[model samples]
Target: MTSADRSSDLSRAGRLRLAVAQLNPVLGDVTGNLELARRARAEAAGQGADLVLFSELFLSGYPPEDLVLKPAFVAACREALDTLAGETADGGPGVLVGLPWREGDKLHNAVALLDAGRVVGVRFKVDLPNYGEFDEKRVFQPGPLPGPLGFRGLRLGVPVCEDSWNDEVCECLAETGAEILLVPNGSPFHAGKPEVRLQVMVQRVVETDLPLVYCNQVGGQDELVFDGASFALQADRSLAFQMGEFCEEIAVSDWRRDGETWICESGPRVALPDTDSARWQACVLGFRDYVEKNRFPGVVLGLSGGIDSAVVAAMAVDALGAERVHCVMLPYRYTSDESLADAQGCVDALGLRYDIVSIAPAVEGFTECLGPLFAGTHAGVTEENLQSRARGTILMAISNKFGAMVATTGNKSEMSVGYATLYGDMNGGFNPIKDLYKTQVYRLAAWRNANRPEALKGPDGIVIPENIITKVPTAELRENQTDQDSLPEYDVLDDILECLVENEMSVGEIEARGHDRELIHRIEHLLYIAEYKRRQSAPGVKITRKNFGRDRRYPITNRFRDRS
Candidate 1:
């Protein structure tokens, strides 16, 4: 067919079947991801889908990181895209898959439209996001304002992920004769991010008078979890469809042309869970994918009677089955009877294997060896850290023996203030609650007890005892030691940290929020000093806007205190 003939055919559309594939692709797994796209295309063809839409970077996986810099990796991705394009010769559904494309000296985050055994057209992502968890500018060259790609009888405006966040890309497409807007995203979940996304899409819909289909990637990747709550908005700014969150799905939507605009017919609209439930599910999915994708046998964590460890243990069981999770109590001299009872209670409730390993033997050995060297030095934080080191050593030994990943159980509150012991409690493969504040941890534990998600592999009921959640949190390093002895109360500390970390509020701004200036300064100092510890900490689920790893970056040796 000639170009003019194809353009005329695209203008007259009756019913178009679009299969939105919300899939999870492993980072740097180009060939494997291509196979995933192939399978989804086959399934969509079986359902008579005219087109299959995969999430951003479905071929090379989202955020390929420095791997995209390697020429061989980019070549592999290009090869994979070509192979998938060849499969369209069978008259199957045309595929729109995201991959890294190289032209001249610049590499672009490009989406390819495949049909009839060839790449029909390609649209580069214009908006290269550089803020928050994105560093797209480091590797990817931004494409110019993109117009729509012509697919079989349709002028489809394809916005790659961040392109649809603002008005420019969609507006440019609408002016270029685009009929429908199909946005593919790799948007990671951070608390109420879905609501933020919906608002952004509605604005574009209202601006362009074009129906928008938002498709996001699903599953977890390292610290990032892509909640695939993909949806569609009609030209009238009404929601047409809503997909489920935190799971992989392929939903088919039927679109019809009405005069000069396209409208999505009514389809499935799955209600999203509340904030607490969503956060819990994000942690579960993130942890599960890390364990399974890394091919670990299971996970082992030091389960103290504290709320942090207890909640982590429950999440591990939910992510991996009970049989795959192992909990151990590394008790020291300060370990309380209440703690032992509570730890055992959690293990029993979750139906996971539990063991108690006393750290006294190792703790005493270390103290005795250092006694003479220390001379008359007083036993203080140094001595207290010995217990934590002993417990970390024991957990590592267990992990080495059984090939299970060790899960560190420090919440964001402790991490923010440098309260956690590095190479001690921080020695683990991953942390499920590393991004959550101590206060949020309590709320999630309570929510999990009251409601069990169908995706959970663990048993229902109160796995976390009320005592664990209700009791005062302690490290049990010394006699009757509480966290507040060294840090502020969790409620206050978390709020202050959130201001400093997430909001980037100045000392004056935070103080104006009813916080004492001195307290803010102290927390800010600790937060900066703790950068080194957070740098070494295991990657965890990112449940907040500013996680320690990617979202917030600070130097450890910096002396700049937020005195102002």
Candidate 2:
């Protein structure tokens, strides 16, 4: 008989049912998360799956950060995994899961292959990524490439997430005559990361000629969100079965031998969303999940009716329902009637719950408090910041009373420099549009208003009003306080930010790109000084190649300047 026929004989006893469990687990919630795993297993078994595989780090959640440093947390993970292992002993399907494993004095990021209520084998992660957004080396100790483990005469090779990124794991498994390669990942999202996965998988498939299945985790975890886009490739490096991105799904596909090779039976080949659209959707999902999963009742934000807040509010309503989103107009003495009416019109259009909370009293309260020191000083940007802070405090009070998360509406442009107020306008639990630049914010708002995707939870029709779109941007902190009063225009500002933050171009290089040297120096100065504020800022969706939280890690107290 051919190798294909021989491989087929191994699984010909009955249909080998397989299921993928995409879960949204909270960090450090071991008990609750294991229960979620149990429920998912039962559902998969009920659907006739012979083996159910959950995403990586489903036990205690991914990037547990300093929580992993706690011995008690690792102990809790062991207990949770053991409890789940025991549950599978009653003749249910096998389970493959990821968790933190403490072996003596070392902590390993491991995956357990369980069958008949016992963990038959364990594979520790071999590759620990230390670059951008990951600090695995700080927590996990790497292990050697894992060999195959036998189950009912079938040798299975399981790689924990990053293990498959290197060929050592796959070569060892193939050398050991492993029947299949299953990789469980806690991979976070970045534009076009899924395609990179496909490319890597295809290379492995051509080398080992083994049918590979890649399953990744999903949902927002603080600043990171794992888009669970699971897929399988045939031994011939051809796409076999694929799951949708940014969603949770359990799909079963048959694998049979074809003359010394394995091929997945007919299944879905889902197309991943484009970068721009995917980014928009990720922001919306992150916003929605962070609010709902954290048990926050709703969201509140200042509505200057500017493009940033307008887009953020629309995104908030789209994330949480219209009834759950709250818009407050914290108008100051300089606030124009046009802006007031525009804010109201936008809220009304979106069917959101809005209130007019004038910040005059609070602003005066601060002014009175600081009057002694400011007896004869001329009013300036400091006073403007105080006004912004007053509005921020009022929003926080409302949030405190109502148990709602304040969704700060600052865009990438404002966040790039020191345009945002630290304790004032930046007082929020999450920022939906944090990764998007000012120009992209306008484009997305227009796209969302025109084509309201059913997946979006906001009210249908134009959520962001036209007047808000066309109006000049302003903080409304002082009389005639247009954003241009303090910074460059949106188009120019976004380009500069893209260069300084994303491209990491020196001030001289940025100026060489046609921006004025004085402007570049001023922006660079602002950006460096604002590190302290950004350090204490709330976590938000990361939809760019270089998000502030994870991708960029500059010292808050640095005194270096790159002149060239």
TM-score of each: 0.97, 0.94
**Model 1 agreement with the true structure over 428-538: per-residue lDDT tens digits:** 999999999999999999999999878888789999999999988899989989988998888999999999999999999999989999999999999998899999999
The alpha-carbon root-mean-square deviation between model 2 and the true structure, to one decimal in Å, is: 3.2
Residue pairs with backbone overlap in model 1: 10-153
lDDT of 1 at 532: 92
Candidate 2 segments exceeding 4 Å error: 1-15, 507-513
lDDT of each: 0.91, 0.82
Summarize candidate 2's per-residue lDDT along 23-141 as a digit string, tens digits: 77888889989998888889888876667778888898987877888998989998998888888776666788889998888889988877766787888888898988988999999
Residue 192 alpha-carbon offset, candidate 2, angstroms: 2.4
| Model 2 TM-score on a 0 to 1 scale | 0.94
Best by TM-score: 1
Best by lDDT: 1
Q: How many clashing residue pairs, candidate 1?
A: 1
